[model samples]
Target chain A: MQTLSFQFSAGQPAQGRALVGCVGSGDLEVMLEPGTSGTLAIEVVTSVNGSDARWQQLFQRMFSEQQMPALNISIHDFGATPGVVRLRLEQAMEALADD
Target chain B: MNDRLDQTRQQHYQAHDLLWGFAPEHLPLNAPAWVVEALQVEPPVVVRRAQGTAGTIAVGVRGKTRDQRFACWMPRSAVSHSVQPEQLIEPGLAQAHRDWPLFKALALLAEPLDQSGLRWGVTGSLGFQLASGIEVIHPASDLDLLLRTPQPISREQAKAWLELIAQAPARVDVQLQCPAGAVALAEWATSRSQVLLKTQVEPLLVDDPWAVEHVAP
Candidate 1:
């Protein structure tokens, strides 16, 4: 029962190059759409089944460093490692489109 | 149940039976002693107290508030119970067992949804136990429910849920009045529309499609 949510606003994209990305072993999915809401909503539900504090720390740091807009992101993890989560989140953020 | 009670408690049980009569379903098998303890107080100021002697008390309060109204019979033979402390019916607590079958239906129908972050609460008139200019014209009258959820619901799903609730077996009868069905939920979503009253039989839906607003900010 762990949840991670964050909001971000990335400036308009000049061209389409998959605003978000996906990074997982044998299972990766990303949703890219025009941003209507000012802030992007990111939700991640993972089955990594570990300490909640670690998840939150990694998620917050990733979100703060990236600071991308025009995207809402989510990730469902099944034992996906930190490197994998970071990769998937970046892909998702990049795939997003500007409205 | 009566066969197990002591003589004194038995007399009290008989007294209650004489006053409230018998409802096998409604009778609390183990009447929470707290209810009796609470009743010993001013018993939450009632909204509409019964007028005549021995009239069953029907009090109304809001779900968010603690105010309780008691509708009880006051016969000349016995003195009204004195108030007690440690049990204060704060304002806004709604109780509606005496007037409408809606509350009864809610009590019977509500079951927690799994892992959906959805919770159901009763607000407005039924939740408040006050008439929102609505009348209970039938013994099978339906009451309104406030459905708070994280995911968007399709019109088909909403209707199906209503049908499920209507078909459930219980002490009270229920009829569902979904505003989305009347006006078309998809069409409403396209226009960013909120629910509006169409007629006496219909209820409205407001801000239901979006996930952000669905969950509390």
Candidate 2:
């Protein structure tokens, strides 16, 4: 298991908690919960080992591009492809936005 | 009266029967150990299938407090009544099965289990999407299945099932249901000792389902 943690600046606080995706082959599970601080904290647990740098780069790019709110996101990945990971992250943010 | 009894006998329960009995709080202290244990996780609503005895039905109990799911058996006599899974499945999954190729393929693969007296249902993100009408399934999402079987399966049988399921176009996670409870077939086949099983109350690291009883602390 590979664990990576990062924090990013966000605009506002999210109201509710939402969970998206499942940790399966070529997929991952993302859980978005309201955070205490004003920043977005992301922690990822992936089956793909030795990809910490790639994960960090992907998350940093996503945070910089998306106007996300203050939330705590936890991802459990089961060898998800980059495209699938991006999609799940977007869906998790969308779910938080809907709330 | 004989005809009425015959009609009732001929009416076998199908997959995804939602059975309701006395609430957990209302069950007597002396109720069957399994029933009491199962009620502690989910409510009395049991998802029925054709996997148990004639008078008993299989139910899938999912824990709201934890990431656990259990396959249990309950006596039909105790259940006040039951309903179909269609009533529980939201419209999203039905619509997706028609429009999405992956879900459509999953439906096709699952279609044969019922005929073999083994019932199958989705339980992971796809199941959540079906229940909540949410778009939780991604292009690479796996098809996690909760399989109900009439009896305990041997390691060889479990391995055969897994090999068969792995042939699907997408990744497939199959949880084999036994008389006592359910455990991932992969774990059951591979683990030499202490296989982790999702029981009605909590997750237990036991040698086998037969050893899973009163696991809660």
Candidate 3:
């Protein structure tokens, strides 16, 4: 059960689609697209299946912690741990923050 | 033993000071001060008056047998000896060792992407203070790695690397994420892999977007 989620807010769409990448064996890729929706959404795809419950717990924890606004978040997970997921999620937020 | 402990403690303090010096305000919230002290260690080395090698110490880890211990050292006393602390002995070193398997694993499995084009910088434990805070010498913890790859990362590569490292050793944990894409990746993975992988991962924001640094008045 290795999943992550987050969101951000912006007055308008970002300059470009925020892209999060990985290549460290076992990990998946990520692409975040902004939408007309006021709130941002997050998605994750991982190789390790059958742990949605755990993913929900982790996502809920992070979402409440960050209190982010509106944005679409996406993830491709191979088998990453909570820590790696955390870092990657943070990286994505930071990339969006830059926008 | 006391001297060894003191030296180890000094190394610990040195790492702490260095980390603070680099990023004073922004510290790893969960990481404790003692944890850093525990992992900061001196490679086993003892300088001898008799040897008179300009006070350069002979460092070596002890072994089950004296013969085995001696074998780990250089053939010649002055031939430059380096001691590798056992995994259990130090937390920081242990983390480095723990990460070795996965780092190497990624190197072996990853589709060859020429990093030469990328403005790649492998910074962190490998630098000075020589501490990654993953050793058992004091309080052991997880491994931390920062990879600022050349170009922006692709979604496919991110998930692949994450899964690969996570499957390495159960007790050990590995994280490979872009400094910028952490948050977005978290959101994206939620819907796609929400069932298993995404649930376990937690991503966040890095690179200090605020630029907290400023000049003194």
Scored by lDDT, the top model is 2
DockQ of 1: 0.01
Candidate with best TM-score: 2
Q: Ten consecutive residues with minimal summed lDDT in candidate 2 chain B?
A: B62-71
lDDT tens digits by residue: candidate 3, B23-128: 2122245544532343235222211101112212222222221112110111222323222211112233333443454344334332322232322212122222
lDDT of each residue in A41-74, candidate 2, tens digit only = 8899876666788888888887777767888899
| Candidates 1 onward: DockQ, in order | 0.01, 0.04, 0.14
Model 1 chain B poorest 10 in a row by lDDT: B13-22
> For residues B66-106, could you state the per-residue lDDT of candidate 1 as single tens digits?
11222333322232331211111122333434444654455
Tens-place lDDT per residue, model 3, A7-97, is: 4443444344656555332344556676544565667755455657766777777876654555566777755556666666666665666
Model 2 residue runs over 4 Å out of place are A5-44, A47-99, B1-93, B97-101, B214-217
DockQ of 3: 0.14
Native-referenced TM-scores of chain A, all candidate models = 0.56, 0.90, 0.71
iRMS per model in Å: 21.1, 13.0, 12.9
Docking class of 2: incorrect
* Reference-based lDDT, residue B49, model 1: 14
- In candidate 1, what are the lDDT values of residues A1-99, reduced to their tens digit? 355565556655323334322222112334545454456565666533344677678766876776555555555543344554565555444333322
TM-score of chain A of 3: 0.71
